[model samples]
Target: MRDLLGDQVLDLLLERSKDGKGGLRLTGEGSMLGELVKSVLERALEAELSSHLGYGKHDPAGHGTGNSRNGKIGKTVQTGVGPVRLAVPRDRAGTFEPVLVPKRAGRISGGLDDMIISLYAHGMSVRDIQHHLRQIYEVELSHEAISNITDAVLEEVRAWQARPLEAIYPVVFLDAIVVKVRDNHSVQAKPAYLAVGIDTDGEKHVLGIWLAKTPLDHATAGESSRFWSAVMTDLKNRGVRDILIACTDGLAGFEDAIHHAFPHTTVQTCVVHLIRNALRPVARRDRAAVAAELKKIYTAPSAEAAFDALADFTASDWGAKYPQAGRVFEAAWDRFTPFFAFSPAVRKLLYTTNGIESLNYQLRKVTKARGHFPGDDAVVKLLWLAIINIEDKRARERAAHKEKTGKIKNSPSTARLIEGQRTIGWREALIELDIAYPGRIR
Candidate 1:
């Protein structure tokens, strides 16, 4: 590469790098490095045009050749150091294509697009990215240009959303996080539903994300059955034949939605959500006492025993004071008792929607800064970038752990939307799940 620049250009570059104060400036605006890059690229393009025309410039043996240098076109390209202006040699035949710097391309440097995507993934807005590039790289980019770079990933997001899934998921957690989006000339909160499925191997995968078309009602704060049914049908269409246990936060009609798509699946209402709702009406001082009593019902030896515990709690003073607490458990008793049928190890995984909630927590961190998204596509774009960022970070962590320990760690205390890490005690839970549902594990 340096040989292509030749000695004269190299010496000029070095001479230009020195400042009047005896310092060297190799980066930022008007840097010698940018100038060197510009010079090399222009030289390379000229060489390519010469090779295409089958002769050297101004040394043609025949003057009647069909194609010749018509003139030069002025172009500016983005580089890591900064933007560089260049004069690309043109040909009369219009068939000379430059490989070093392709026509109609604004960026010539590799990894610049990926860097912009990484910033967008980490929650930097388009304006933020524009300012960052100008301030740090001394390169100016318009908001539309930055958006165009990030928008390139929308196709990848579509492909990922429509990708095929495993025939069976041992456990799938369903949940949604509300994001404010512009709708009907106003900003409204809309739920972006997500499903995180634990494959037969116990590794987690985010099945897909669906943005609600209409805003959710803040008064009811309930998820729509129609929206979830479409999401579930999308999963079914994508090749999820069965889900052994589906855990949810008791969203409205969530049970029916799951059952409508996968009739045999067991829907387990999230026990933690239940506990939180039951304690909503309790005073702060009495919440601890009330929670201990509520724990007895979920921790009992069997479903019958758990019912007995619930009855006993209803008769106790704390339950008498907070009757609505016991009623909250009774309201969702059918969905809540499915986990009790399994052993403690399996019940631990089935009893809560913590896995999906943790994923929502990470997504919220990415979207929290935005006052409202311009549209559903914008919301999906940002969230999809955030998911890619998360999976990439996890991949690096796993690779580092494997390098240091010579083996990968699989035991995470809670189920996470990580591809390689397995849920702790999943082997034992799988054994129980396999026995509980014959032929479904496959």
Candidate 2:
């Protein structure tokens, strides 16, 4: 329903229902708002019939047609406020299908659908949603009814997964989270891969999601490479011709797969992930100092400086005791030092898989509620719904920020100014990319 129409109807109801004792009064059973909604819906149904018949009521165009309106049929539909009795138009040919509310739909209000979807997205289970409806709206819906409503988004998820992507993404962050799904009647942990991309304009977008074919113990080089190869192949198939930088955790074989998929793409290991991994072998008493020393490498002015710091760290007491930590850094040195080549702004984006990691955090909240999904599709559906809600919240935040700062979200040049920063490394980073990659930016 149009917001303006609903607001106008609400205003009319409130103004006419004033107690006339200079105070507001409650609009009960035959309330104007309820009646107005019923009237509008009935009129819309009539309009649908008219269009299907190719003429207005009693018009000459429908005179000889066998699809002319027969008479009105009584159908009591449930609305947000209460049950509304509507006289639906019917035709002789029975070809008129109401687009506003399908014939099989008992509840006709858009408000109810929004409420159900919002509740589901907020982590309410099916039973919890049903309870909310019953307790608040006094409407008892069957399990089938609620399932049908939520399952309607399956096709949406499918289409979103298959949608074409941008030709070029300056940066893409890849990561995964484990979700339990039923496999051959037994539940098992499976990885769901997420790719988040930064468009040419600096806005963030989720590229797509992929579920690994097998239940891998960890994101090993062989396993991660195979999974990422499939993901990159799909992205390329969907129009992603080039990706400049890919930020990822130290998943073995990931960098090689990236090079093979998008030959020129630079793969940066998430410095945060490296820090976390390095801290694992350090003694708790020495963790703080070890973390402090590790920070010097990532935050160093250049790769040479970072290497120098690493060399110094290896000779330190903590490094000698927790030699594994140094070895871990050494193992991923190539991927870890790529961020030092770029400006701080670009480094801020490329130095971590935190983009997709944050997304995984949100997905975890929803998936955690379900002990195990019935199947992979169920896992995808819940995560997809959660992603939609997350994106919506982010959009609202962006809009509010724009209202407060009067700066557009997509404006790369003014973004730093809006963010109250001296430089937005992204623009300069793009220039460096153009010079480095040659013809890849456009």
Candidate 3:
């Protein structure tokens, strides 16, 4: 490459790259690296134009070919290191199309869009991104340009949201997290509902994400029957014909909503939610004892045994003192006891919605940095990007762990609902599910 540029040009580049203090400047504004990149791209565009015209410059192969070089067009493009200006070659016929830096493209390919999206996914606001690029890459981008770049993924998000789903998901978890969005000229909290499904192959997948239009006004406002029904209907329309078990965080009317879409899907209230709700009213100091007492009901060997344990707890001192705690379990007992019908392995998988909760936790970390979003689209866009970022990060961690340990870690915490990563203990769980719901496994 240095030989191709000749010794004089290479020496000039090296000399230009040297800082006044005797160090080298490889990046940032006015760096020789940017100039070198500019030269390489301009040369590549010229080559492409030559290929398009079927001749080299001033070759004189045919003087009367009726097509010739016109002049160079100046264009500026954003790059990872910085922005570079290029002299794009044009033709007399206006037929040349340069593939290296296509006409009207403000940013070059090769991961600039991806980098911006990744940064946005990790919770960097548009202004933050602008500052980061200006400070680190010495590239100045307008707010509108940065927004347009990130907004390009809205189409992808729509396509993904409308994509067909599996016919049969052995288990599906429904949950929602609240996010602040601008509405009615003020910021209001809204629910972002997510559906995660586990297919018959034991692989996990996030079915879709929906941002409810109704702003949350109270604790239960985010979990509504109408919104959840729409979500369930969406899954059904997208090809989810059967779900053997639907786990939820004990949202009001959630059971009826699931039944409305998939009547055969057994609604199992999330044990963790039940426990948390039960412990919420208990004194913090007594929570440990209350939780310990509550565990006996869930861990009981059978539904009848669980009921007996519940009765015993209600008669105990902790249950009498915190009667609401016992009522929390009693209210959810119908949905809660479904897990007792399955084997212990299956029960472990069906009893909780931890996978979706973990995903929500990650999404919150991304959204928490921003006090509020401008609109629903902005919220959806950021959350979608964050989900992609999270799954990618998890995938990298899994790959790294496998490389170092020569074994994949099948831990519950790593059991994400995307990328087809199998949930821990799913194989054993599936066998029990097959027995529990004979024809549903298919």
Clashes of each: 0, 1, 0
Candidate 2 local lDDT, 1-442, one digit each (tens): 5586687767877776565585654422244555776788998988888888889986888766777888988876666655567888888888878998678778875777777877888878888888877765556677888777888899999999999989998888888888877766567787777777877776677777777664444332225677778877899989998998888886666777778989988888888888898899777888888898888888999999988988988999877888888888899888788777767877786777765676688778877777776777877787788888876766666687799989757443222211122224567777876776788888
How many clashing residue pairs are found in candidate 1?
0
What's the ranking of the predictions by lDDT, best on top? 3, 1, 2
The ten-residue window of minimal lDDT in model 2 covers 413-422
lDDT of 3 by residue, 67-158 (tens): 88999988888998788877888999998877778778888866677788889999999999999999888788889988999999999988
Ranking of models by TM-score = 3, 1, 2
* Candidate 3 Cα misplacement greater than 4 A, ranges: 1-12, 70-73, 92-99, 215-221, 401-417
Please provide, for model 1 over 295-402, each residue's C-alpha lDDT reduced to its tens digit, 9 standing for 90 to 100.
Answer: 999999999999999999999998889999999999999989988878887888887888778778889999988888888888888988898788777777767778
TM-score, candidate 3, is 0.90
Instruction: Report lDDT (Cα) of residue 19, candidate 2.
Output: 55
TM-score of each: 0.89, 0.75, 0.90
The candidate scoring highest on TM-score is 3
Candidate 1 — which residues are off by over 4 angstroms?
A: 1-15, 18-26, 57-63, 92-99, 215-222, 404-416
Q: After superposition, how far is residue 380 of candidate 2 from its true place, in Å?
A: 2.9
User: In model 1, which residue pairs have backbone atoms overlapping below 3 Å?
Assistant: none
